[model samples]
Target: MTSSTRNRLFALGALLVAGAGLAYVAFGNIGQNLVFYWTPGEMLAQGSKAYGPTIRLGGVVQPGSLRWDAAHTHLSFRVADTDQPGAPSVPVLSSETPPQMFRERIGVVVEGTFDRSQTFTSSRLMVNHSNEYRPPKPGDGPDKWKTTVSAPTAEAR
Candidate 1:
């Protein structure tokens, strides 16, 4: 091969290797930052494999299972797969105050790690509101929606 051709080939091979290395590093960082959300049942199904990495748990807060400290610094609750009765639930403990919208039977996503004790220690809690807009039921009366809508203006004096 000619000297010019040999130098060109060497440069092309170096470019290919550099591109591959760059792609590898980009994907490696993405894989490390990709967090997954799992339901209680799904996480429980993982058994011992679920204990290490931080994961988001999505579910409904089980009714009557919430216990909050007086100072509002600590809270614990059981999260169920769904609002339906008898659904599987996992206990969650969070150091932060529950959001104002957080309430029993509402959907929530808690981000944290599951410990050997089977409790999820969450560092963040997010309330998941339904996207569907529901209108008031028939015969519910306008009073039921007073808080959601502004009152009608009285005639100007």
Candidate 2:
């Protein structure tokens, strides 16, 4: 090939290599930031394969399994895939305060790593509130809905 042709071909090859390098770096960064969501059952099913890396654990907070320190800084709870009997549950530990809407039987998504002890140590906790809203049924008292807002007391007047 001619000298000019050779130089043009070399330049084109360099450009392709640079493009590929850029694409590689972009994908590497994306993978590092990506966090996969898994349920307790799925995580357990993965066995030791799920131990490393930060992930989001999604499940319902098991009733009567929630415990919090008197200072409210440390919290522990069990997350179950299903509320039905015989369903498996995963224990979770967090140092942060639980969300305002967090309570037993509510759905929660916690971002953290699973330890060798089978406990998930969460760095972040989020309450998953449902978007659906339903009105109170007829003949039901206001107290039936624990979330009903109470009126102001006379002492505040």
- Best candidate according to TM-score: 2
Please state the error at residue 103 of candidate 2 in Å.
0.4
Q: Return the clash pairs for model 2, or none.
A: none
C-alpha lDDT of all candidate models, in order? 0.80, 0.78
**In candidate 2, how many Å is residue 107 off?**
0.6
The number of clashing residue pairs in model 2 is 0
Candidate 2 local lDDT, 10-89, one digit each (tens): 99999999998999878767654454567788889989998988989988988777776556567888888976655778
Scored by lDDT, model 1 comes in at 0.80
Candidate 1 structure quality by residue, lDDT tens digits, 32-54: 44545788988899899999898
Cα TM-score per model: 0.62, 0.62
Winning model by lDDT: 1
| Poorest lDDT segment (10 consecutive residues) of candidate 1 | 148-157
